[model samples]
Target chain A: MSDHKFTRRIFLSGAVVTVTALSLTGCTEPKTQLVKIEQAGAFFNPDDLTLLNDIAEIMIPRTGTPGAADAQVAAVIDAMMMTWANGATRDLFSNTLQKIELMAETLKGKPYSSLTLKQRQSLISEIDVRAFSDEVPDYAEGYKRLKDLIFRVFYSSEAANADYVPIPGQYRGNLTLDEYESLTEAYSYGG
Target chain B: MADEFDVIVVGSGVTGGWAAKEFCEKGFKTLVLERGRHLDHPDPEYTDMLAPWEAENAGLMPESFEDAGRYSMLRKKGRLYKSQWARFFVDDKEYPYSFPKDRPFMWTRGYQLGGRSITWGRQSYRWSAKDFEANAKDGNGVPWPIGYDDLAPWYDYVEAFAGISGAKDDVETLPNGDFLKPWEMSCAEQFVSDNLKKNRPDRPMVIGRCANLSEVRPIHTELGRGPCQARNMCKQGCSFGAYFCSLSSTLPAAERTGNLTIVTDAIVTSVLYDDKKGRATGVSVVDRKTKCLRKYKAKVVFLCASALGSVQVMLNSRSDARPKGIANSSGLLGCYIMDHFGGAGATGVVPGFEDRYSFGRRPTGIYMPSFRHEKADDVDFVRGYGYQGGGSTRPRTSHTGKKVGIGAAVKEHVGKALPWRMRLIMYGEMLPYIDNRASLHPVKTDDWGMPLLHIDAYGRDNEKKMLVQAAKDAEDILIAGGCINVKSSHVNPENHIELGSRTHEMGGACMGSDPKNSVLNKWCQAHDVPNLFVTDGASMSSCSTQNPSLTYMALTARATDHAAKLLKEGVL
Candidate 1:
């Protein structure tokens, strides 16, 4: 469920304060809080985390709101890979990363990590277009899965600040955008 | 005296909860035996409060962690099985049952203090007069000893206490109950309902009557229950007591009476019978974890374990006088098994109403009571089916089968909500066939040293034809309401829908007039054994195309009254 009271810009800015508070000594964690940001992204090595982080940022770049990087979607992915993914899924992701590196080397004469932001963006755009196109080859399939996962993880994250109501006491069958927005704003935060 | 209770109710699920509440309220010392681990009210294991991202893997369980082979059915079913809420469901590797090698039966179970009532689909509907008379009219199975009139008062009683949310829709096939205010339909749903009324008057669409408390009553409030918050995360136990469950409503009421005792991890192995006295004296139980045996004495025993659960227990309760099984003189303890056939439906997008969107996730949908209920020349099936569907607006996520480019553009695209799209899934009554039955596997036994239930139920011609008609009618209704791209799924040729998928399994120890042909009587009392009663889905002579939990609760409450009266009058 999404809570739309605070916009992504507001939530992203507020996150800086949250991070500072989290690091402060003698400040107890929230009672019901299960997972922390530090616990995530531990599955992947430094190089893989870097690649994942950059690719996630490219997939959902920061505009007027927080992007995939701010959402820490890549960290979520790493956590999932460490704990959730099976052998088959892990292999698929690993191979897909290797393929991306190979593609970067073949096209721009360097590894994907070594490329400039502009070069990486152009290469990713090419891959994204080819992956979704009707004439997509088997190689592009993994990219489609990766792209979908990135979007899914980002949207589900707290940084996305999508309109969600954990507990709206009543149901309204029909409402205008203005009415819905006001209602969500009123019943915003929940555990 | 320490091990004895006035009444022992086996299983603390939908029926068992009601039984405990009623008997305890009536001042009987009731002991509820649960085969699973104890779960407290507002269960600590609940993930209902967890945010989407806060859950591990965003609520998806890791593939490597779960057992693929043992939980093959759940693995194949996907989604719900692989969710964080899978903690509520039983592990198949531990509590295994068997069916035919070729035919798979998905017996979805939750082994906890509240049982499957913790995760029940909450849709509440009353079966009509036609449902009761179907068996006799069609000469299929035995006639129901009780009719709609017999259960109407009981239904009213349960509906008041349980707090059903439904309108008085004046539909004969679906009788209205003592209800709280019904949940509101979405704008798109209202439009479709109006259109169906104007054009297809015969097929009326009404709001789903569910167990969720739309408005809290004094009876519900007194039990510490509150109004539904429209969170829709009910599968994970609700702490607010907004939705009706054993842990939320009935069990707490039972506990307040101070006449109720509960024993967790006590698997009821059999009902101890006294042949000379012609009474069920007590229950034999095995400790789930330690495998230690114990017996609890009771004046009366209510087998409110699920339909199959009761059937398995009854079939295994063999004695010298009743060599086949206790209270099984009819030799039909595990016969005429029935579950709703489903998985055939239509989905389409409504053209307009883009600007209108509903606030709060209402934990209900629209229900179309079966128009094919009566005998008609047009229809080839015996019983009928109902459609549970709803209209909703969503952004073009992965669920919508749309392809969008990456980056800012895709993010923007997903932000804007799409027009309301509608989908309908049908639940048709599976005709009670004698051959489609449950029996003990000759040799196989579980770790508890109880016989493994071998389910052999499958859909026949009636179910197949009904599902096919259901799909056609669903598409026709959507088309009439001006929906586009109406696509209907076809029934599988091999096995119609997987048996027990709908989770409304009913009919094994069926109630009928003749004791020679049935296990129980009109009052759900065992004919051969007076003090033993089955008030669960097991006593149903006919499985109607409605959610059966409400009926089971009503029956348990009514039967408890009858049993209590008899106990006081020294009838037993």
Candidate 2:
């Protein structure tokens, strides 16, 4: 089994340590670190990063192959939010996190952080079905969007395939219908 | 003192990059001017590594940016911020143009050193001999000043460096290029191509000739680029110079020569003409960063600033000798704008073949070369259209709105994902009509104060007719290949080019044999100004259905060599 732990500490130590430190320091020290802050604005917070990982794990939890969380989709999401997303999007992300937390409190009578893995998994499954069926009207759309983002990030990510998905080596231009069908199916299912 | 060079190539785009490389290689001091900010090649910015989910709006275009209307054209085309890599490509405040109420011109573009070449669909195909002679043979637009023979060698040269990966299709309508090893087709695509070839022999489908290097040749390896690792993340800009964009290929070569000097954030306002010498002496520019005016002199000038952009510059270059414009002696400087009519084709699903899978993401599709104006045996339209499309298995999105969360249901759904056979798209050719021209608007200017191009181009009757027929043909072929749920979509005949959809926008300052009918002479040199050349798509007399960058590169190389020889022999 692959270690799918995507802790904030690990992320901070890896690609974004300097950016994270600069941003945190900038908030404390005002005038001198303005430029650094402006540049560091293109970095995500540790909590949001962890939330992204949790969301990916919830969306595409590991089965036979490596799942979204294992790919460090949270880190990928964090990088994208900082660099590409605009203001309203950041607000939406915050709202989504808040909503997820609220849902956990309502369902399990505890914060998502305090829930065990099994409890967390149960809550995620319940929320997903409710969102899919349009039973939870308030959080449905946001949850769906979040689910799609997680899947898209994972499916298109390098970590989604691992050894499970069959990546075609050479193109063969004269295959039978059956041969083509099998190949396309493997591609869709991530092998 | 104002910096003087042997040549000043405006716009480091497809043609400009080629001109810079050729001139620099020829040992001429060349300065490439770009209005956008300078972006270094290879690892210019690290944003390319980002994934779509990482995006704030989940790769959606920001409402604020859309409201500003700066990238209205780009946004309309569905190219949203999947990553930070695409953010720098558009400025949401400046660069505005308006189309007529009913006519929506999606002028999708990027203005970095490499221009839109970074985001371009690198589908490279050589124009057939028939395409070169079409204008004259059919009495459409002006006849091409030069033909396939003139461009053949340059095509070979550019192909060698660009590293096009494709199979040699001996179809006369779509000539084969000097190619590297072709990328493998998806199994579905292979089935379709074989079936289409057998069932419809007239339409021969082959792998799309693209600039993505499947195998790194010595020339490409020298440029610090490696072979494509089959990562389909091309539109975001390849970090590996595995593809041929100006940033990846030509501009880098020019940089190595040391004679190349690139001045970004400087927009060329107008070409300064010397009436006595009958040539362009220099160019006046507006610094985009500071709004300051600057002038740069050169012995020769190459207007490689895209199709409409070059035409705008030429039309703005008015002198006392020619009050209309510098190269408007023929009154055809800013006329006959043409873009290939895209988005007409059929898509369907193929059943079975659930076991065999493939590896690596192929960035391109199978190409069905044009069969329409081959022998001219009872063809309705004068010109022809070609097919560029591919196959893919239906992804999880196909089950969108059908399934719910990430559980057993999702797993079962993913396991049983349907095999979507292929989608065939026919990019039809639009003939050049005299009325479909671009000119200066009465009262509008870009950020640099140059008059905006009032483009009034649209596909004519013949083009519309061709698209309709091509759509029908696409449907028939898909149906014959055992594709289910085959459906055809007709391209909107009006504004089908979508202003800048193809980005192969051609013909404003067109090339022709007669100076009375065309702006540029046979060598792509301006008829009025011998030293000034427009070697971009503006030099194209007619629009062929194929992607135009390869042709533009070939023309630029030929023109560059011609200009160098002329300069060396004191012809200039």
Q: Write the per-residue lDDT of candidate 2 for residues B1-572, one digit (tens) a residue.
A: 34898999999887899999999999999999998877887653534455433333345443555545556665555654433445445653477655666655555556778887787788888887888988888888999878888888889999999899998878877777779987777667767777877887777778788988888889999999888756566776777887888998999999999899999998998998887788888899999889999899999999998888888888888866676787888988778888887768988886565554544467788788777765365556777888888774333233232357575356445644456567888777788887777877779887778777777777667777777778888888888776888988886665444556666788988898888999898899998888999999899998888899999999999999999999999998
Interface RMSD of each: 7.0, 7.1
Q: Which runs in model 1 stand beyond 4 Å of their true positions?
A: A1-41, A129-144, B66-70, B320-323, B392-404, B494-496
Candidate 1 C-alpha error for residue B215, in Å: 0.9
lDDT of 1 by residue, B1-572 (tens): 48988999999999999999999999999999999998898876776887666655655555754535545556655766645467777767778999988788888887888888888889999999999998998999999998899999999999999889999999999998878998998887888888898989898989999999999889989988888898888888888888889998899999999999999999999999887788888999999989999999999999999999999999889966666777888889889999887878998887777777678888999999888767689887787888998884433444211354667776665566777888899988878888888999899999999999999889877877877778888999998877888998867745635787887889899999999999999989999989999999999998888889999988998999999999899896
Error of 2 at B238 (Å): 3.4
What are the per-model numbers of colliding residue pairs? 3, 14
What's the residue-level lDDT of B569 in candidate 1?
93
Index of the highest-lDDT prediction: 1
For candidate 1, the TM-score of chain A alone versus the native chain A is 0.73
DockQ of 2: 0.15
- Cα-based lDDT for every prediction: 0.81, 0.73
User: TM-score per candidate, in order?
Assistant: 0.92, 0.82
Give me candidate 2's TM-score against the actual structure. Answer: 0.82
Give candidate 2 regions above 4 Å deviation. Answer: A1-147, A150-191, B46-63, B79-81, B374-380, B392-406, B415-417, B491-497
